[model samples]
Target: MDLINNLALGLGVAFTAQNLLYAFVGCLLGTVIGVLPGLGPLATIAMLLPVTYSLPPLAALIMLAGIYYGAQYGGSTTAILVNLPGESSSVVTALDGYQMARKGRAGPALAAAGIGSFIAGTVGTLVLAAFAVPLTAVAFKFGPAEYFSLMVLGLIGAVVLSSGSLLKAIAMIVLGLLIGTIGTDVNSGMERYSFGLPDLSDGIGFLVIAMGIFGFGDIIKNLSDKGTKRELFTKKVENLMPTRKDFKLMLPAVLRGTTLGSMLGILPGGGALLSAFAAYSVEKKIRLQPGEVPLGQGNIRGVAGPESANNAGAQTSFIPMLTLGIPANAVMALMVGAMTIHNIQPGPQVMTSNPELFWGLIASMWIGNLMLVVLNLPLVGIWIKLLTVPYRWLFPAIVMFCAIGVYSTNNNTFDIWMLGLFGIIGYGFVKLGCEPAPLLLGLILGPMMEENLRRALLLSRGEWSVIITRPLSAVLLAAALVMLVVVLLPSVKRKREEAFVED
Candidate 1:
C-alpha cells in the first residue's frame, strides 16, 4: 500500500508540465541519436551532461534515462535496414533483421522490435518498482567479499555471453582490464600505467573509448565493406502494421526476453547487452514449426526478442544503481555522478530519504518508454532513408561530430586523440573476430572490483580466505565457477562452434 501511495506521488511529480515536456524531448532526441550510427547512449548522455546543470535533478536524470532506452529502439531500425547496428545491443538484431529487410519484410521486423520494446519496457518498469527496494535490501547485506565475488561472476558472464571464440573473448576482457589499469592506483595513488603522461594519470576517458570503438570503429568497418556506394533496402514498406503471424511469432519472444532481461538487468556489468545476446540465443534454441521464418534469415523473433530484452534490461538496470549506489553500466555510473551533483546519495536510504525522486524516476520510465514507442514507430520511414546516404558523406560527418562531442567534454583535444587511438584498437578487434561486449564489462567492472578487493582485504586484515569463507561470497564465486566449467565443457564447446557456423 505504501508502495502504491509513493508511486501515486511519483506520477504527480513526473506529470508536471516541465517534466513531461523534457520527457518528450528526451525520447525524441534519444531516437535521433539511436538512429544515427556510432553515437551511443553513453556518448550522448555524456555530451548532454554539462547542459543539464540548470535543470532539476529528477528531470535531468529522467531525460538521460530516456535517451538510453530510446537508442535501443532506434538501433534496431538501422540493424534491420542497413545491416549496421546503431547500438551495440542491436548487434544480434542484425543477424536476422537484415535478412528480413532483404526479403522486403523490414516493416514487420521494425514493428516487432518497436512493439516488443513497448511491452518489455512497461513490464520491466513495473518489475523495477516492485523489486527495487527488496533487491536493495539484499544488496545491503553484501560485504566487500560478496561484492568482489559478484564482480567476478559478472566478468565470467560477460565472456560467456560474447559472440565469438571463448579464447578471443578472454583476450578482449584482458585487454579491457589492461585499459582499465591505465589510470592511477587508488590505494597508493601511484600511476601504474600512465606512461609519464599527466592525462594518463586520470585515466583514459570512457567517452573516448566508447566514441572510438563504437562510433569511429563502426565508420571504418562500414566503409571497408567493398562498396563504393551505400545500399539501402528500399522496400515500399507496405502495411506498416504487423500481420497476425508476426504477432504470434513475436509474442513468445517478447515474453521470454522480458523475463530474461528483468532478471539479468539487476546484475552489474553489461547487463542490458548481455540480456539481448542471451535472449537471441534462447530464441535460437527453440525449434520452430514449418512456415516460420528461420532464425538468422531475417526472422521477426530475432529482432523482437533482443530488442525487448535490452530495453527491459536497460530499465531494470536502474534498480541496482538507485537502490545500492552500484552503477551497473557506464551510463548508470554517470547517473550516480548526476545524483551526487544534486546532493542526493544513492543507496538503501534513497527510498526513505527521497521517496519522491525515487518513485518519480520509476514512474517516469513508464512515461519515457511510452513516449519512445510513439516517437519511434512513425519515424521509421525517416530513419530508413538515412541508409541511402553515402558513406563518403556520412563517415566524415560522424567523425566531425565525435570530435566536437569529445572536445566538449573537458574542452580537451587529448580526448580526441584517445578516441582515434581506441578507434584503431576497435578496428583491430573486429579483424580478430572478437566481440567487444565483454571488454566493456571489464572496463566498467575493473575499478569496482579493485575497490572491493582492497576493502575486503582491509576488513579481514589481509586474509585471502575471507572471500571463500564468507557465505554469500562463496556462493557467488561457486556459481560463477560452475557456469564457466559448464560453458567450457567439450560438448558445449562443440555446440557453440556449430551455432556460430550455422547457415
Candidate 2:
C-alpha cells in the first residue's frame, strides 16, 4: 500500500507538462549523443552541468538522468551498425551486434536490444523503488564510524572492479584523494594546499574537474588519434521486429541480466559497465541452443543480455546516491555535484523531506524508458544516418560548448585555465593506460570519508578501536580487506584479467 501511494505521488509529479517536455528533450538529445561516436554521458552531462543551474532541481535531474540511460539505449545502435560503442558499456555489445549486422540480421539485433532494454529498465526501476526505502532505514542506523567504513568498502570495490592494473587504479585513487585535499581544512581554520591562492579556498569546483577531464580530456584523446577511418555499415535494415523464436531466446537472457544488474547496481562502484561485461562473459560460457549462433557470431543472446544488464545497471545505480548519499560511478558523481548546486542534499532525508522530488525522479525513469524504446526501435534508420558525420566536425562544437558552460559557472577565465590543466592530465591518464573513473569516485568520496573519520574519532575520544569494535563497521572493513586480498592473488588476478577481455 505504501509503495502504491508513493508511486502514485511520483507519477503525479512526473506527469506535469514541464517535466514531461524536458524528459522528452533530454531523451532525444541523449539518443543523439549516444548514436554519435566520441561522445558519451560523462562528457555530455559535464558539458551541460552549467545550464541546469537555472532550472528547477527536479526538472534538471530528470533530464540529466534521461541522458544516462538514453545513452545506454542509443549505444547499441552504433555498436550494431558501425561496430563502434557509443559508451564504454556498449563495447561488449559490438562483439555480436556487428556480426548480426554482417549476416543481414541487423533489424532483429536492434529489436532485441531495444526490447531487452525496456524490460530491464522496468525491472531495475521496480527493484530500486522496492529496495531504496529499506536501504534508507539501514542508513539511519549508521554512525560516523560505519559511514567511514562503508566508504572504505566503496573505494576498495571501485579499485577491484575496475578493468585495469590494480596498482594503477590504486595510484589513481590516491592521486584523487590528494587532489580532494586542496581546500581549506574543515576542522582547522587554515588552508593546507591552496598555495595562498584565494580561488583554491573553496577547493576545485566539481564541474570544473568534470569538464576538464571528461569533456576536454575526451575531446583531446579523440583528436589525437589521427585520421581514423570509421566504417559505416550501409546495410538496409528490414523487419525491425523480432520473431517469436527470437523473443523466446532473448527472454531468458534478459531475465538473467536484469536480475544480475539489479543486484550489482546497488553495490558501491558496481554499475552498468561492469554488469554488462559480466553478463556478456556469463552468456559466453553457457550452453547454446541446438540451432542458435554461438557467442560472438551473431548470437541474439549476446545482444539481449548485455543490453538488458546495461540498462538495468544504469537505473539501479541511483540507489546509493539517493538512499545513502554515496555516488557509485562517475555520472553519479556529477549528480552529487548537481544536487549540491541545486541545494538538494542527497541522503535518507530525501525520502522524508523531499518525497516529491524523490518519487518524481523515479516515475520519470519509467516514462523515459518508454520514450527511449519508442525512439530507438522505429527511428533507428535516422540514428544510423547520424553515422555519416565525421567526428572531426563534431569535436569543435563539443569543445566550444564545454568552454561556454564552464565559463558560465563563474563568468571567469580561471576555471577555463583549470579545465585546460586537467584536460592535459586526463590525456596523460589515457596515454598511461589508466582509467579515470576510479579517480573521480575517490575524489568525490574523499572529503566525506575524512569528515566521517574525524567525527568518529572525536566521538570515540580519539580511540581508533571503535571503528573495528562496531559490528557493522568491522564487517565492512573486513569485506574491503577480503576484496583487496582476492585482487592481489596472482592466480585470481590472471583469471580476472581474462574475464575482462577488451575484444
Candidate 3:
C-alpha cells in the first residue's frame, strides 16, 4: 500500500508540464550525443552541470538521469548500422549487431535491440522503485564507522573490477585522494594544501575537475586520434519490425540479460559496460536453437541480450547513489555533484526530507524510457545523418561549450585554468592506459571517508578498535578484505583479465 501511494505521488510529480518537457529534451540530447562517437554521457553531463544551476532541483535531476539511460538506447543504433559503438557499453553490441547488419537483417537487429531495451528499462525502473525505499531504511542503521568501511570496500571493489593493471587503478585512487585533500581542513580552520591561493581555500571546484578531466580531456584525445572511417552496412533501414522467429529467440535472451544486469548494476564498479559484456558471455555459453543464427555470426540473441543488459544496468545503477549517497560508477559521482549544487544531500534522508524529488526522479525514468523507444525506432535516419558530421567541426563546438560551462560555475578565470590543467592530466591518463573512473570515485569518496574515520575515532576516544568492534563496520571491512584476497588469487586474476578484454 505504501509503495503504491509513493508511486502515485511520484507519477503526479513527474507529470508536471515543465518536468515532462525537460525529460523529452534530455532524452533527445542523450540520443544525439550517443549517436556521435567519442562523446559520452559523462563528458556531456559534466559540460552541462553549470547549466543545471538555474533549474528546479527535480527537473535538473530528471533531465540528467534521462541522459544517462537514454544513451543506452541510442548507442545500439550506430553499433548495428555502422559497426561503430557510440558508447563504451555498446562495444559488445557491435560484435554481432554489425554481423546482423551485414546479412541484410539490420532492421530486425535494430528492432530487437529497441524492443529488448524497452522491456529491460521498464523492468529496471520498477526494480529501482521497489528496492530504493527498503535500501534507504537499511541505510539509516549505518554509523560513521560503517560508512567509512563501506567506502573502503567501494574503492577496493573499484580496483578489482576496473580494467587494466591493478597497480595503476590503485595509484589513480591515491592520486585522487591526494587531490581531494588540497583544500583547507574544515575542523582545524587551517590550510592543508592551499598553496596560499584563495580559490584553494574552499577546495578545488568539482565542476573544474569534472569538466577538465572528462570534458576538455576527451576533446583533446579525440583530436589527436587519427579518425577511423566507418562504413554503413545499409544506408536504408527497412522492415522496422522483427519476425516471429526473431522474437522467439530475443525474448529469452532479453529476460536473462535483464536479470543479470539488474543484479550487477547495484555493485560498485559494475554498470552498463560490465553488464553488457557479462551478458554477452552468458549468451555465448547457451547453445543456439535450430535454424537460428550462431552466436557472433549475426545472431539476434547477441544483439538483444547485450542491448537489454546495458540499458537495464544503466537504469538500476542509480540505486546506490539515491539510497546511500554512494556512487556506484563515475556517472553517479557526477550526479552526487548535481545534488550537492542544489543543497540536497543524497542518502536515506532524501526520502524523508524530499520525497517528491526522489519519487519524481524515479517516475520520470519510465516516461523517459517510453520516449526513447519512440525516438530511436522511427528516427533512425536522422541519427545516421548526424553520424556524417566531421570530427573537425564537432570538436571545436564541444571545446567551446566546455570552456563556457566551466567558467560560468564560479565566474572565475582560475577555474578555467584548472580545467586546462586537469584536461592535460586526463589526456596523460589516456596515453598511459589508466582508467579515470576510479580516480573520480576516489575524489568523491575520499573526503567523506576521512571525515567518517575521524568522527568514529573521536567518538571512540581515539581507540581505533571501534571500527572492528561494531558488527556492521566489521562485516563491511571483512568483505573488503575478502574481495581483495579473492581478486588477487592467480586463477581469479586470470579470469578477471579475461572478462575485461573486448573481443
Per-residue C-alpha lDDT of model 1 across residues 1-503, encoded as one tens digit per residue:
86688789889999999888888877877787777775678767755665677789889988888888888888888888888787888889899988988887877888898889999999989898988768767887989899899878867866765556899888877887788888789899899888899888889876677777767777787777776344576555666678898888889999999999988787755456778988998998999878987898878888889899999999988887888776666678667656876788777778877888889889998999888877777777788776566658867877887888778767987898888988888888888887765676577667778889999999999999999999999999999999889989999978756544424
Per-residue lDDT of 49 in model 1: 62
lDDT string, candidate 2, 1-503, tens digits = 88889999999999999999989988988898889878889999999889999999999999999999999999999999889898788999999999999888899999999999999999998888998889999999999999999999988988888888899999988988888999899898789799988888878878788888888888899888886576776656788888898888999999999988888787777889989998998888889888988898999999999999999999999999999998988889889888989998888989999999999999999999999999988887799888787777888898889889988988879888998999999999999999998889989999999999999999999999989999999999999999999888999999888877856
Task: Report the error of model 1 at residue 370, Å.
Answer: 1.3
The TM-score values for the models, in the order shown, are 0.84, 0.98, 0.98
C-alpha root-mean-square deviation, each candidate: 3.6, 1.2, 1.0
C-alpha lDDT values of all predictions: 0.81, 0.90, 0.91
* Pairwise TM-score winner, candidates 1 and 2: 2
Which is better, 2 or 3, measured by TM-score?
Answer: 3
Backbone clashes for every candidate come to 2, 0, 0
Model 2, runs deviating above 4 Å: none
Candidate 2 contains a number of clashing pairs equal to 0
Instruction: Give the Cα error of residue 119 in candidate 3, in Å.
Output: 0.8
TM-score of decoy 1 = 0.84
Instruction: Select the stronger candidate by TM-score from 1 and 3.
Output: 3
Candidate 3: stretches off by over 4 Å: none
Model 3 poorest ten-residue lDDT run: 227-236
